[model samples]
Target: MTVGEVMSKDPVSIREDDYMTHARQVIRDNFLRVLPVVDEGNRVLGVLSDQDVLNIRSSKSNVTVRGYIRETPLITPDMDLLRAARELLDAKQHHAPVVSSSLDRSIVGILSDVDLLRHIQPTKRSPASVEEIMTAKVETAYPDDSISRIWDNMLHWDYTGIPVVSHKKEPMGIVTRIDIIKAGYARIGTANMHGRSSGGSMRVEKVMSTPLYSVAPESSISEAIGEILRNDIGRISVTDGGRLVGIADRHDLLRACLEGTGL
Candidate 1:
């Protein structure tokens, strides 16, 4: 498979001069975690992500995309899908901008984790089981865990989502970065009026998403990929006899694809 065959075409881009608010709006509106930044001629300059926004203490209305731009590894349409996936992982990004394979480097598309996983879902290429890529440490939270501490761990470990497990170590719900920002962002000052602080008093079940989406550890990578693509989720919890075993996210998929572990 090649990048051109699976990449999302005509990707939505943020202009270099666009306000940071616009960037945030674009990300939220498109349900995107990352977006490419482009020049006036539609050439990629950098990328913007929700994580970048989350890191900002505060952004002024005039703060342009340039302030938060992050350079990404560029890809070409003719590049091997696995090779492109490798580049993305090495660059610590879930997506990359694809150029025309010409001297001008004009942006033509965007290749993302979801795109690659979508392609892998149909192929028998990934023969590996979920155990190969799943994280064994499996950081988790309880229903009563303080949101402040949970948020700290999430940012510290770069965990996009953490499974909320019961005392018996069974999966209950999941709290994601989006869930925190959504529930806490606008409720900051209102905490005092409500007689409770935002994150400090918020419970896991209060903001966590319920009805977990998951895959068994013995399942094929393709099965896991299918779960991710079909559900439009960032990662799949790896379970064993209904217990949380681990998690397989885009980074795992990139490693699998890079090594050609499944074919």
Candidate 2:
């Protein structure tokens, strides 16, 4: 189907002149991970996501939001939703801005991967359970593990996030790339670069985000999608009675769509 058929019209956007703090709030309030950067005339300028805002905040940079504006990926209104989805996946972007070519690249709508999935998949069918698609070999971290070691593990595994587990092997929390980025920002801001190595030497239990959100193995794909959307998160850990089992991510869901549609 055409992008216009599924693109969210008149999406909540931010101006180039706005502040990073404002952008952060806008994203959180709207349950959005990305926002289109627009001009006074609603022309598309660029796009920003939670990671960008977090990076800015993490850096403790004094620059305004406009300073962060650069060339953002764009798609024409008439583009196919599947093509657009593929572009987003390739770019690892959560949202894409849809502009009208006849209107001087004027922002007309915003397309998100979730929207594309909804359009391409039949939601009414029996929802696929998480156990059926989740990656069973989950990478995990120990609570007492040093952050430095954990960071090494993350880089070695090329993981965006890793679950923190207790000595009993129970899921305790989660540590994400964003979290490490924030920690690095904090370290730089505090002039504690040397101290960071020592800091990173500390246990991950000190910084990992606890009370993680998760899904059960039997839960339907619909439920998983809803949780991902409602939480504005990129990944979800699957559990069976408080024990970590598998992991599901946006890529997994998209792959399922592609395979099911024979694309």
Candidate 3:
């Protein structure tokens, strides 16, 4: 499939002149994590994401919205979906602006990781087992670990989530960036009202997502992809029965596809 097939046409966008507050409101109202910036002629200029907005807020900068504008990764409408998806994953970008090949580089649509996964789902061929694609070096966390420490680990590793494991090496649960953010709010609220540090003494068990989504090592690659897509997650832990073994991420699937197609 080509990018044009899966991209959202006429995506929502903002002008450089728009206020930061307006951009934040647009994201909230639309439930969007990224927004494109365009010129008056509807040509692609830049893009903005939740992370960029958060960084700006944290800096406490007095700069205008123009200063927050970001240069976005560009993809042609005719590009192969798989290739486009791989580029986005490699860049760690959630969205890319689809532009016309013509002189103007006119904004045509937007391609997101979610859209690429949807396209790959039905065409996926089952491999013999998850062991064929799973990466054995998996990052993990302990249940007793504090939220502050967990956040530091996540940031250091650039991980979206980490599996919580017991002393015996059995998976207990999973803790994600979203979970930590929620916990941060809870921590601040408690600390301000109760004069205590929520993160200083609290444990990962109190905030981690339980009933972790797991896949058996012997499962087919197609089946594993389906599971990851179903969960709307970036990675999945591979296990043998109940023992942690490896992991399968979006890049693994892309690499498999590229090798299979000799791309």
Candidate 4:
């Protein structure tokens, strides 16, 4: 299969000159992981991810997309699906703009890890367990922790999601970047930047995704993938006897698939 077969065509994009506030709204409204940054002629520039938008302090900020635009591999629609996944992984980005050709940078579509996941199958090689690829040293947030504190932790550690745990370390829920963004609390750590006192008062439990989905350490990679796709979540908790042991995300599963298939 090819990238064009799975990629989202005519993706929502922002002009390089657009303000970060607009970019934040576009991403929040569309639930986009990344927004393609384009020129006036619709040529691809780069992309602004949800993480980038977290840097915005107020809804009235005048920062342009150009400064925050992150360079990503430009994918062509004709590229092999697996190969495109590999390139995106290597670039450490979940989304990439798809152009017609190398010489023509005009974006015709957009590709994402989720797009690739829909077409991926369990590797033909020996199946691996989720434990083999999960990130064990997870940073978690307590339910009582202030959103401001959690937000600071997420930015300081570059974490997409942090599991909210109980005093005993049992997973209760997960707070993610989108969760904060969707709740209109993307400000990295400026609780008083715009006098948004409520932003600092909010608790992790209020913004966290509940009924946390999880997989056992011994579960197959395919099982973990199924849980993620089924729940439409970025990652799942890896638990053993109801205790959080690790976390497995799309990148981990994608890597395992590529390595196992030797793609």
Residue-wise C-alpha lDDT for candidate 2, range 49-119, written one tens digit per residue: 66556444243334557877656566877887666776777767768888897457798888877787666
Model 1: ten consecutive residues of lowest lDDT: 186-195
Better of 3 and 4 by lDDT: 4
Instruction: List, residue by residue over 1-263, the lDDT tens digit for candidate 1.
Output: 99999998888888999888777767756656778998999888878876665444343557788978897887999988767776787888887889988476789999988777666433345546989778888889998886666766776687788999988888998988778667753222334212345535667787899878988888887788778778777888988898888898877864665453432
Candidate 2 vs 4: which has more lDDT: 4
Quick one: best TM-score, which candidate?
4
The TM-scores of all predictions, comma-separated, are 0.81, 0.61, 0.75, 0.90
- Hey, what RMSD does candidate 3 come out at? 4.2
User: How would the candidate models be sorted by TM-score, starting from the highest?
Assistant: 4, 1, 3, 2
For model 3, the local distance difference test gives 0.72
For model 3, how does the per-residue alpha-carbon lDDT over 77-189 read when each residue is reduced to its tens digit? 88988778767866667788899974667899999876777676423443567788888988888998776666556645656689999989999889976676555522222
Segments of candidate 1 deviating more than 4 angstroms: 59-62, 121-127, 146-149, 180-200, 261-263
Residues 146-226 of candidate 4 have per-residue lDDT tens digits of 777777777667678899999998889999877877787665445432234454577778789897799999999889888
When 1 and 2 are scored with lDDT, the better candidate is: 1
For model 4 the TM-score comes to 0.90
**Decoy 2 TM-score against native:** 0.61
